[model samples]
Target: MDENEKDRILKVEIDVSGKLHLTPEKKKFTLIYRTATEVHWNTEINTLYSPKPRDWTYLEWFKHIIKVTKEECYCELNITEQTEWVNIPNELKKEITKAQQWL
Candidate 1:
């Protein structure tokens, strides 16, 4: 696989509510988002990283999960810093404002 394909294999997205989502690039539209509640602590997130098992030992899988998650996080952080928000959804903005009142 090319670099782009490798990078695109897994992604992390943030929602208006500051919720994190894990989705594959091609299936981003179909899979949409998998919220924390929807993800199983062990199995689901690993599956999101790679649907098929990699024949890795338990420790290997653990290390891979940490490495990939960190890489994706850093990738997002850089992209977010460089990009500008052209438009913010008013409804979600308002919802956030209203929710912030509780704090």
Candidate 2:
């Protein structure tokens, strides 16, 4: 996937009514959250203009699931696992930029 898509995935948040916190599937990138009950409480479905308020993020939704199911839940995503970033000295950055200008 492209960097933009990766960034988007990193920022993805969805509310679900299932036991699973977040399930990433195909179709570009789909996160399926399953709660104990079969009822769907997606905040996206209740848009801002809708009668219901759209105030639940994925974390909030998951918390609701925990309240209803009373099950221990934990989800992890290593977004930066593939990339490492370190501070670069200003002089080194200038040198790198100068070198790039030659190419």
Candidate 3:
């Protein structure tokens, strides 16, 4: 995927129902939650492709699976009141900042 697509994905948010909410357009996408092991096995079987193979971290895998499934969005399971900000990737951070300006 290109930088634009990646940024789009990064701008998404998860709603209370565990659904992914896309930005600007406010489109909702369903997610098929998968374990890291499942993703790994799928990759091994050629059922999935890492967008960034060199940096095939769990987050990348999550993004890749979401893109491939063509789902609306992803919500990290087990979110709580104490949920904290994840370490946003530099590229994604830029997108978030840009997105905030429109709010």
User: If scored against the real structure, what TM-score would every candidate get?
Assistant: 0.23, 0.21, 0.24
lDDT of 1 by residue, 1-103 (tens): 2232222324333334433334433322223124321222223432233222245432233234334443432221112222222223555334433432332
RMSD (CA, angstroms), candidate 3? 12.3
lDDT of 3 by residue, 1-103 (tens): 3222222332334334333332322222322235432232122222232333344543444454444344323322221223233444567545444543332
Candidate 1 backbone overlaps, count: 0
> Which residue segments of model 3 deviate by more than 4 Å?
1-25, 31-59, 71-86, 91-103
Off by over 4 Å in 1: 1-54, 75-103
Error of 2 at 31 (Å): 21
- Compose the digit string of candidate 2's lDDT tens values, residues 1-103: 2222112012222223212222212112112235433323235322111112246533344334323322212322222222221233455334433432332
Model 2, CA-based lDDT: 0.27
**Between prediction 2 and prediction 3, which has the larger TM-score?**
3
Q: Total backbone clashes of model 3? A: 2
In model 2, pairs of residues that clash are 17-35, 18-34, 18-35, 19-34, 19-35
Ranking by lDDT: 3, 1, 2
After aligning candidate 2 to the native by TM-score, how far in Å is the CA of 8 from where it should be?
A: 27
Lowest lDDT 10-mer window, candidate 3?
40-49
